[model samples]
Target chain A: MESPSKTYQPTSTPFDVDAIRRDFPILERKVLGKPLVYLDNAATTQKPSAVIQSITDYYTQINSNVHRGVHHLSEEATNAYEGAREKVRQFLNAGSVEEIIFTKGTTGGINLVASAWGRKHLKAGDEVLVSGMEHHSNIVPWQMICSEKGAHLKVIPINQQGELDMDQYTSLLNERTRLVALVHISNALGSINPVRRMIEMAHRKDIPVLIDGAQAAPHLAIDVRDLDCDFYAFSGHKMYGPTGIGGLFVKKAWLEKMDPYQGGGEMIKSVTFEKTVYHDLPHRFEAGTPNIAGAIGLGAAIDYLRAIGYDSILAYESDLQAYASEKIGSIPGVRLIGTAHDKAGVVSFVVEQVHPLDLGTMLNAAGIAIRTGHHCAQPVMDFYRIPGTARASLGIYNTRAEIDHLAETTRETIKLLS
Target chain B: MNSTKVAENSIQAAQDSIIEDFELLEDWTEKYKYIIELGQVSPGLPEALKTPDIKIKGCQSNVWLHTELKDGKIVFSGDSDAMITKGLINLLINVLSDREPREILEGDLYFIDRIGMKQHLSPTRANGLASMIKQMKIYALAYKTKLENAN
Candidate 1:
């Protein structure tokens, strides 16, 4: 709970980020012998050497199935794997490790909720509210659940800033609203939701809330206790951990009420030929063999992040985002999307006449990695009435020099395409 | 581009001889043109699949694919918001469907590079193409080898 000093900005942080780029081994490699400048952090962040080593250490030193075995290697693996759970608990500042249930990234976590909670609590004519800015992972699960239960799915609209209209959201929330699942930070547009307020507003109507923290987990500090949302979901890969690992944090009360998501090995306590008793909260949701290596790697990613400090990382990233926005905003025919007052590290844009796919290709040739298209937020695109945008998302490792290169390359690309 | 035409001609020639001899066409050019033509055949996407949930990321054009497997062959029906991309997808469906499980399992997508399309795509579109290819290949791989054996 110790906070880093506000004035303690490190001067050792390079002005020319290229000088500090050596820390990332992947950046050292060339794309066609051109140095790799990765900017697609919103899609997934590249692993640092520390994270890579941590995964290697686990496999080399303690590579056994976790939790079930009573032997030495099994004990070591369980501790290491559960130790990662504790790290996740601390990272999100959740009350207990039991609150964090690992799954196959955000999509799986959301599906777990839909299948488990939606089937049990939701009935025909109930409504599930979502924002226009949600990823498909967040949107489709609710749609599927609604379609099955005959429940309705409603959307909160977005303005030019990409921020959801709170007034409209409030109006949409009636007694029939069963749940409201929203994105904490938009991956397509950099809009950061007022989650604390959103959670409070939904709770007033006795509606349980789920925050899609997939975009927020990497850049911002998450305190579930502070937000007090009923459920939260995030992916490991988006935050510089290994892929195939993510967590769903459910409030203890809600977890108890919901049916088990999947039924398989390790999820059951006692199985007779006639009847089976399910395990307690969290374990009941996590069934079969889990992503042990990925969980351990996620722990390493959290450690690396904590060592650097999230406060400093957030500040540095925010500054860079603002700088890029201002500079990129000045370019002729370049249109910026999602200009919310409070935001995260994503910057989605469109150059006049050039398709995002074409722009992405040209930028890749320049050794820049960017994301293009709807960014899995098709509803957001529909709201804006555009097919998609070219997005450059930042990470802790990104530098201002890269952003400058992005702007310069964007200008050149526009000229070529125009 | 000329080689692509010649390859297409050869594929056509091979097709005329026998369905089994279609594999005799050695290069990607004919395959790519055929792929593009297949895309051209992609039905005008039904307005229904354009729902917020079904949209494919990284595509320059709004493209949607819904697959149904009948008999032994996987039948893909898709549409794109853009004409050229629909053509691109039609090309994809042709290469992706009606292939052996082993061929799909091995995922020899090097054919994309041979056809010169990979070089042309923007990184996002390239990624979309890669993702779409991966999806189709997964269907082929998941085809239960028994299907081929039964046939």
Candidate 2:
């Protein structure tokens, strides 16, 4: 890997963010009659008007099944649906549309691979490597698969600062290692795993890698081709699209080897009384009626992202995150969690004398939205010996002013509680 | 309509119906939804009881409860950011509150099992109810010991 140039500066984004906020009509409204300052982007993002309109437009105009029917509506829906597939291809910069398989979301994608791929390939002595900072979605699926297949699950421990122990991860890789499944970014801690390095290491050992990009896709630029990950999964809702929609990018070679997760109509080529043949690489994985509106919304979300420029969004979010860390972490009794050197726009902290729920309530009263509790990372909480932490995650439309408000409310809360 | 006298008569009748000694109850699934309905009618804790000490750990919302013993009846005050949980606490307090301190100190939480409210709770909520009950019982025991020592 080439070292980042000391003098080199990444290109900065220049978009009218207020105008972008206007694109998301939900931001115009308030929660609990107070102006909603939604900072829970890590949980799910608010959809832009384009994304919302796309869903309405799809159902309003071209609502039909795709890849099978010959009617005009089906044709239009097929084009629009496949068009969204192309958008997803461009969104992740994957090699081909054939590589993108739509699923319910990241959870569905991981489960699909685990049930179809892990179940077939893994044996009693095989091991699946995952990081300590994984969400329950990432961890539980593998654990379930491993337990059923009689395979062992190995965890790559994090340091005190919540960064993965790369040395330990490398040591854990050996002959019995069937796969290395890791999150590209920690949802709870916002720690960016070194995917390129991890992928390369796993490749050398001939073990396939699956990168959980649910957190990363929302906050960063992801090119599965560039990363060379065997499988990458992310949710559209986290990327400003609607819920119940997402995709898994499986390498063509691997998809050919893996069996279909579900057996249904579209996934079949020709069904006979005695025998049935499966469809091609991507189609084989996508069975049943798809989320046509959701796929359209996801495409529009990608457009919204592209219009603002992914690099610029990442840069601006990174800046806001750093500013938030400095301002919020400076408050007395507030200890920041997930202090990885490479982090996304997420700040998680715990106050010395206040439970995260109390902090969340006070923040809610102030009209500032933040996530409280384990954030679906119970093992991480158990590791730290704390119940949970309050998290405020930033998005492309978020501003420094919101961070200031978050800090101010947090400070005021500590004072009040004390 | 003599409603006050009727209410007193009903209270006397309810008292008359009380069981002697603790009785182990069966799985209370038949009454589960009603207990949940009871949770619906449960009121919010007083604003004064919202404090850091009584906060239920691991919940997504803030929940606080304070209990007091006066005239041999336990009284509870509690509140929460979330509505259903507040209602749940209210239901819990309504049953356990106003009970004899000796009964509370006896560590017989079988009525909760009898009611089978834990079945409806998420694992987190169930654990939280356990902790709250645990704290309440501990508080009652401490008070009982103090009363005994004072005598």
Candidate 3:
């Protein structure tokens, strides 16, 4: 009575993905004498020429120090760097530019929150609630801080579908819960949690929440105002930009109360032997000279994405997800790992008797690159009782044709392996 | 008494033979196929001998190794969960298993790069290969110390 394409909901926007693919030069290359089908976007997306040019533009022209420098080059460089912060503010829909802090990556952003905000707010007996499906970046930072403060670190369990157990999460919240940090979308399993509901629940108990948006930023549209979350964090490289750059979106209220993440130049207004006063908002958190070119590149990436429009990206990716879930999911010997009803840009799976590493290697030989192993979320793998899953995560540029190739390749590999 | 042992020529001849055999293979796929075939001939570790203490640490695939000293030769047996890794382990065992501790410690093992294996292996497997060789050398050094003490 049902059809396979029943779940495939076509989006409103008309997408020209072939034109988009042409923008990324690496997509035109070959992997193993065959066309490269890059399904590793969740690991790191391929940068477009626009983003690459922005980086080159920085080096070729307007290359200088930011903030403290008075020279012409410094002003130009500082303008570009600060302009990137404004882009991030607009990108996340955060309240102000002052609320956006530059970081090394998502790990650095999470660590900054744990160190600066956690030190002032948390104490012994307080609990930091995190979901079971967090990447090590989210888990370890909270773990480090919780352990340091003699506070307990509580976990929100996940069901077999890899969705967070809301009943358990709600039950665990109490007067002792100081804060909650959850992933926007799980990198390992493509489950998108009901973060708005969870954030509201936490706010009821006066507990601030931090959403790790590393995986979600590239796939979904995020609005800090709509989510009403206290903090949001994401990396630039995962969004088709340069590496060594990411941003943390903290609410102005939280910024006012929290101490500086690091003590160094620029973070301080004036330094004396016995007296030191810190700067305001974002700069208070970012201590050293920031990644000037990387931030500018990230800004360019945002501009490119904005031009394509999120609606088009969403529609295209959903089409890819539905197609992948059906085609790749239906293959013989392939057991789809995460089958959450509300899923996003990834299809994680395993073939019978074939280790993920072997499967990935065989696929690589076929010139299809899919990520293998724990995906830096070992707890998620442990929960699933798996060594790892071979993941094919989608980006805006991925096509349904590529999905068919993936399914065909996987089916052939399974037969060969079996 | 030593249960089973190969001839003196067999241990050293294995490396030369493998290099010659790999030269016949045309591409990475063929080399990999040959490697998987080689895993079939590997002297798998006994259930009792597959102890956690002797497992290779850095390999992405789990590999258990056991070693012994017979007539001053460093006898070895190993197994891996993955066929390709198992084959690679078997190839190592064939070449260096029964060679003298000092010979293994000083052996070049140039055949890794000579047969284009260095280029073919993935980054993790390359690290695993280096770790395997390092672990083998560590075992030889221990035996070398024991042999010296016995003197």
In terms of lDDT, the best-performing candidate is 3
The C-alpha lDDT values of all candidates are 0.78, 0.79, 0.86
TM-score versus the correct structure, for each prediction: 0.75, 0.78, 0.91
TM-score of chain A of 1: 0.95
True-structure Cα RMSD, model 1: 10.4
The sequence of per-residue lDDT tens digits that candidate 3 reaches over residues A1-418 is: 2211111112222478877787888999987577899999999999888888788778887778889778878888888898889889999998899989999889999999999999999999999999999999999999999999999999999999999999999899999999999999999999999999999999998999999999999988899999999989999999988999999999999999999868888798889999998987789888888898899988888877877778888887888898999998889788888888888999999888776777777677667888999999999999989999999999988988888888887786666556
Candidate 1 stretches greater than 4 Å from native? A1-20, B1-151
TM-score of chain B of each: 0.60, 0.64, 0.89
> How does model 1 score on DockQ?
0.06
Each prediction's DockQ against the real complex: 0.06, 0.07, 0.33
- Residue-level lDDT tens digits of model 2 in A1-418: 1211011111223566787777778889875556889999999999877777777777777778888788877888888888889888988899999999999999999999998898789999899999899999988999999999899999999987999998899899999999999999898898998999999999999999999999999888899999999999999999998999999999988887899879988899999999999998798898898888888888888877876777788877888889999999999999999899999968998899776755676677567889989999999998888889999998988988888988998897677555
What tier of docking accuracy does candidate 1 attain? incorrect
| Cα lDDT tens digits for candidate 1, A1-418 | 1111011122234333443354457877877345678999999998767677777777787888877889977888788788888888998889988888998888888999999999999999999999989999999999999999999999998898888899999999999999999999999999999999999999999999999999999999999999999899999999888999998898888887889967898798999999999987678787897888889888888876776677888888999999889878889999999899998989899888766755675577677899888898888898888888999999877887889998998897676544
Query: For model 1, which pairs clash?
Result: A360-B123, A361-B122, A361-B123, B35-B91, B38-B90, B39-B87, B39-B90, B39-B91, B40-B87
**Residue A211 accuracy (lDDT) in model 2:** 96
DockQ of 2: 0.07
Candidate 2 vs candidate 3: the DockQ winner is 3
